[model samples]
Target: MFRFTDYGEEDAIRLCKELVRIESTDPGSYEGRISEYIYETLRQELGADGVRLCRSEVLTGRRNLLAELPGSSAPAGSGKEEPALVLICHMDTVVAGEGWSEETGGPFSAAERDGRIYGRGSCDMKSGLACALTAFCREAGERRLRQGEKAPEKYRTLRFIASVDEEDFMRGAERVIRDGWVSASDWVMDLEPTDGRIQNCHKGRVWFEAEAEGVTAHASMPEQGTDAILALSYFICALREEVAKLPEDERMGRTTITFGQITGGYRPYVVPDHAKVWIDLRTVPPTDSRMLRELLGRAERAATEKVPGSKFRILLTGDRQSIPPCPKSRLLQSLRQAVREATGEEAVVSLFPGYTDTAVIAGTLGNENCLSYGPGKLRLAHKPNEYVDISDIRRVMRVLRCLLREPLR
Candidate 1:
């Protein structure tokens, strides 16, 4: 067998193909075996030159890959010194969906057709990981100088963090955020698939659950006990109506609410005595999660008033997303300039509809001087035939490389 890293650009396509070959289908882990392959490749093929692998302490169920390349021992960032930059992306994809395309052999089977690399997660995220790693390696190789030789006066470091658990739960981002694990990097760049546009803002997320309890009563004797299903249903409808009334802002888009999950009592002979439901909400900027806590409180009250015989309670217990607003810092301007120069396209800045690890780190860092962009196409993510254009991959690689050489403002 041959190593994928030793091959040329043509070889990288095949490497991606091989990656798609793994049946990573929810074997209790999102990254599956492919992440382990990348981890091993980074350690062996990429070699020890400037690469440091740090495992994720928060997510031992799945691991995070943190790689840092120290540019120089210089202390300051680009005003008089260049500041360090961190590149962030995730490693997990949503669990495979059923009724998938047969030709792709259930999503992981990578197939090449008409200049596209086809497979699950090929677009949603895995390709962006390749883009960042390739840029880091190419930049390092190009900047090497002899012991006595002096390279350019650049004095910044670059860190790449490949995270896990971004699909179902955001614990990966939450854990890192709570720990303040990142060294004070001058800035953060989330490499999400944006079709080359810079993603500057993203909406915040909230996940909520409600439970209704009632005394069990036989189907033949309805008057003997209360029905929990009635109580829960009342809350569900009222909550949905309230969510529809959530305020909408012109810039960040409207608030969104969805009934993600619901459950009721079992067996046909007995009336349902207990029920629960999960609600997920997306908020425009400035809509604090305190709003959700209040909303749940209101729903509990509404259910109790509607159904006296039954007990009703609600809990807002899930990972909520922190917003990273559009930054106006010099580093942001530098990035935009590099992006425009590389693509000849003006950047379109907007908030991401989904959550990411960058939000966590940015929140803990206590600032909005952060930004995220990537090569993965957003529409095809987690869909039937997920794939990323090879051209986008090369274009982003060039942009990241150019960013290393440009003088910071």
Candidate 2:
């Protein structure tokens, strides 16, 4: 098994700092600028080991820059084999709007202070991405001595899949599937900011819309028209009560529903006849979504029973399932070893409360053997002044290197 202490600290810090300087966020302002930066860095700096760039269809100016240094003791074509372990990282950040004055100069301006790198994506992902890069780069560098006719036939392929658009739509990973980039592999190691924890579970979302129709009447004539707002409030309360009782799963915890938005009013002089609200449902396993439709029927009945003249309707605006706990016992055990090799401490793991692009990989790939590891504190994701631990990046880098070099038994 490979260990975390194998990789150099200086290398990890360099990769993280350079990427942080690019400010690659949502619809990265400098898409070409950032992609080209990687291209030049690897092609020029590590070209001796043979680095290749793979363009993606997701971002126009950007691309999934892949660097592969043919392993020593690996089959000729084995360098691109299935069930292959991939180092996944994104090249984008949320909008850096505020709370970055303490950083270099602005939100995108990265600063290293007190061992933490301060910036927009410093904590959310850039750190993890850098870790993956460092480990893979070391392998890339190691290839210099293993290339040509003397290279070994048994070797692990270290891939650096740096993509774009993970901040918003996750179009990067989506495009990777559409174009069959990683389809050959059973699973990919999603390098997100997990505070060096292994994540294999997360909650998904179901967006629905509920409408309450009411009659309009003059405000002065209280008995003339129906109050849609009042009807909506009553409907909301019933929905809340019904949603509160949703069953819970041991892995993802209890399912939940919340009223995200509501708007319905015609005029100040008239009672609102139209009221609509958006309901968001966080689902867990064994909880069938079809049951929600049944709940809607009950809600309508309750509304009708409460207000004889009031009418209601429900629509399934959106439906997305949470990626269940794959928890591949063997894979987790292997990863635990990797984590130990990557960090001196025991691997910290838990279910990710929110959603992740891992859903895409889990669906397209296998789940049982799937595992996630990366740098950056998840608590900083999507928040202002998000930063990653510079030292943490190096630590994970060391771990990734060992994982790639570890021989298949």
Model 1 C-alpha lDDT per residue in residues 81-163, reported as the tens digit of each score: 45567777777777767667766556776776666777877776767777666666555555454323655655467777777
State the displacement of the C-alpha of residue 298, model 1, in Å, after optimal TM-score superposition. Answer: 2.4
Clashes of each: 9, 12
**Model 1 accuracy (lDDT, Cα):** 0.69
Q: What are the per-residue Cα lDDT tens digits for candidate 2 across 134-233?
A: 6775676566555554535466545667777766556777777676656544446777877767887777677788888888888999577777777778
Give me candidate 1's TM-score against the actual structure.
0.88
Sum up the clashes in candidate 2: 12
TM-scores of all candidate predictions against the true structure: 0.88, 0.81
lDDT of 1 at 108: 75
